[model samples]
Target: MKITGLMVYYYFVCHKKLWYHLKNLNLENESENVGIGKLLDETTYSKENKHISIDNVINIDFIKRWEILHDIKKSKSIEEAGIWQMKYYIYYLEKKGILIKKGMIDYPLLKQRKEVELSDDDRKIIEQVLVEIEEIGKKEKAPDNINSKICKKCAFYEFCYC
Candidate 1:
């Protein structure tokens, strides 16, 4: 399976969700939180060019010129995941001969934004993550759910819990 920016985000958020996603057991369409996020993504950045898909692998929310990338979020509950997702975007573009200065994660609901920059160490970690994700994708069953508060808002909540 191709490693996507969303999959990279899921890797940090929940391994089970990542596995479910890897298996094509998609539940995002049945999610209310996801619906809200989609609404927010559409309405919040009306003026900006959004949903920029890179080689059909990653879909960046937008770009500020060609040097900076922007990703919008509904909240910062899994902020680290969002940060890593941004770093991965920077790394992906760099591998394609595009030099990105940095990335910004926009939490429109919280009225906050966090800036992310790719480091040599981050690139190494992302590389390892890609390998690990491949391993997860090969599993016969979905991994155990995290059973955290975050799960309540996740797209796979019902599938995992109910």
Candidate 2:
């Protein structure tokens, strides 16, 4: 299975989510949080070349001058996941002979931006995560729900909790 950027992000957020998403049971469209995030992605970077897709594997929010990549986020509740997603983008592009200097994660609601750089070690970790995500796609059933605070805000909240 082709591991998209969303899979990489969900891998860090919750493996169960990643598994469910791979099985065509996505709930993002029904989530209020996702709607707000989509709005930000649409309105925040009105001038940039947005939603760059590569081999159906990675979808970048935007890139500035082919040097810096940008991704918009609703919040940083799972900041680590967001950071790894940026690193994965850099890694994927490097493999395609395109070198990105760094990635920027923008939280327009909070008026904050995070600079992400891919390191050699990060490349290795991202590769492993990609393999792990592929393994998730091969699973017969979705992984168990992670009863974390974020679950209450997830699109699958009602499906998993209520």
Candidate 3:
């Protein structure tokens, strides 16, 4: 199965979420948080280059100056996940023979911007993450939920909890 950027984000947020997503159990559309995020993505760069897709697997928010990849986020609440998601995109393009070494995450709501780079060390980590993601996808059942604080705000909260 092909892993999308969302999978990478889910991997950092919760392993169970990652597994469920790999299993094709999607709940993002049902959540207001996701809806707001989509709104931000659509509105923030409405007049700019946006929503460029590659091989129908990776959806980049925008490419600036024909090089830098820009990913828009609603918030920095889970910044790490967004950063890795950007790295994953850069890695994906590099594997496609496109040498993209940098990316940026724009948190319009928070008025913050973070630049991301894919290094040799990050390549190693991403390789390991890909392996873990493959294992998660192979599981027949989703992993048990851990009941973390983030669960309350998760789109799958009702599916996994209430």
Assess the local accuracy of residue 42 in candidate 2 as a C-alpha lDDT between 0 and 100: 89
lDDT of 3 by residue, 1-162 (tens): 788888898898999989878877888888899998888787887888789999877899999875799999888878899999999999999998998758999988888899999999999999999999999888888888988888999988887887
Residue by residue across 25-101, what tens digits does model 2's lDDT show? Answer: 97789788889888888899798889989899888899999999999998999999999999988998999899999
Error of 1 at 88 (Å): 0.6
Decreasing TM-score order of the candidates: 1, 2, 3
- CA RMSD (A), model 1: 1.0
- Evaluate model 2: give its TM-score: 0.95
Tens digits of per-residue lDDT for model 1, 11-58: 999999999988888989878888998999999889999999988889
Cα lDDT listed for each candidate: 0.92, 0.90, 0.88
Weakest 10 consecutive residues of candidate 1 by summed lDDT: 151-160
For model 2, the run of ten residues with the poorest summed lDDT: 153-162
Candidate 1 global lDDT? 0.92
